[model samples]
Target: MSFQEISPADTAESLRNGNAVLIDVREPHEYGAERIHGALLYPMSTFDPRALPIDSSRDVILHCGSAKRSGMALMRCAEAGVPINKHLAGGIMLWKREGLPTIKVDPATGRVFDPQQG
Candidate 1:
């Protein structure tokens, strides 16, 4: 794999320290439902490596419901000659499993809540 995988703990730390930014590769509905607090949405259905907001200041990490889509996104980046090579290993499922925080929106109330609280 040309890409490197980052664990939820490490990803969280990186984000907390402002050393990295997350890119969500899931669809719009999935992103609207729940996601890492600061993750920027860029659905795989319309993902374009050329249009990614990569910069030299911070590393960009990609993620989806699972690592599959993010892995595919990495491949796309590689094919397009984009150098982004990190993803949240095992995705949000693992992130939640690791007890990390996520922003969840209630479909009925449109209210956001902490999954750990509900």
Candidate 2:
């Protein structure tokens, strides 16, 4: 099944308005290195569409390093009868390119900092 793509800017707007839940489908290590500030980790390696916290209150948007994994997850959701069908286009790469806020761990300090600020 086809899925709808939400741009990083628009995704940020929805998140600011509390209208969307961002789910990162990348692996744990990948997420630990850097990620969207409020994105929740739900690695596609162990993804279970049925387990997703889906509700009418918020739109669940999936994303990954480049959108490949999220698209795959969306297809999995479709097969499992889950209604989540939106994702962040171009994934975190594009989000970063667009100068959005991201929480990144500084290897030397192991502290989280906004990459956009650097």
The all-Cα superposition gives candidate 1 an RMSD in Å to the true structure of 2.3
Instruction: Provide the lDDT at 104 for model 2.
Output: 84
For candidate 1, lDDT tens digit of each residue in 1-118? 4789999999999998999999999999999999898899999999999988888999999999889999999999999999999999999999999999999999999998975457
The 10 consecutive residues of candidate 1 with the worst lDDT sum are: 109-118
The per-residue C-alpha lDDT of model 1 at residue 13 equals 94
Note the residue pairs that clash in candidate 2. none
TM-scores vs. true structure, each candidate? 0.94, 0.93
Candidate 2 structure lDDT: 0.93
**Per-model CA lDDT versus the true structure:** 0.94, 0.93
TM-score of 2: 0.93
Q: Mind giving the per-residue lDDT tens digits that candidate 2 earns over 1-118?
A: 6799999999999999999999999999999999998899999889999999897999999999899999999999999999999999999999989988888888788988875557
Candidate 2 segments whose C-alpha is farther than 4 A from its true place: 115-118
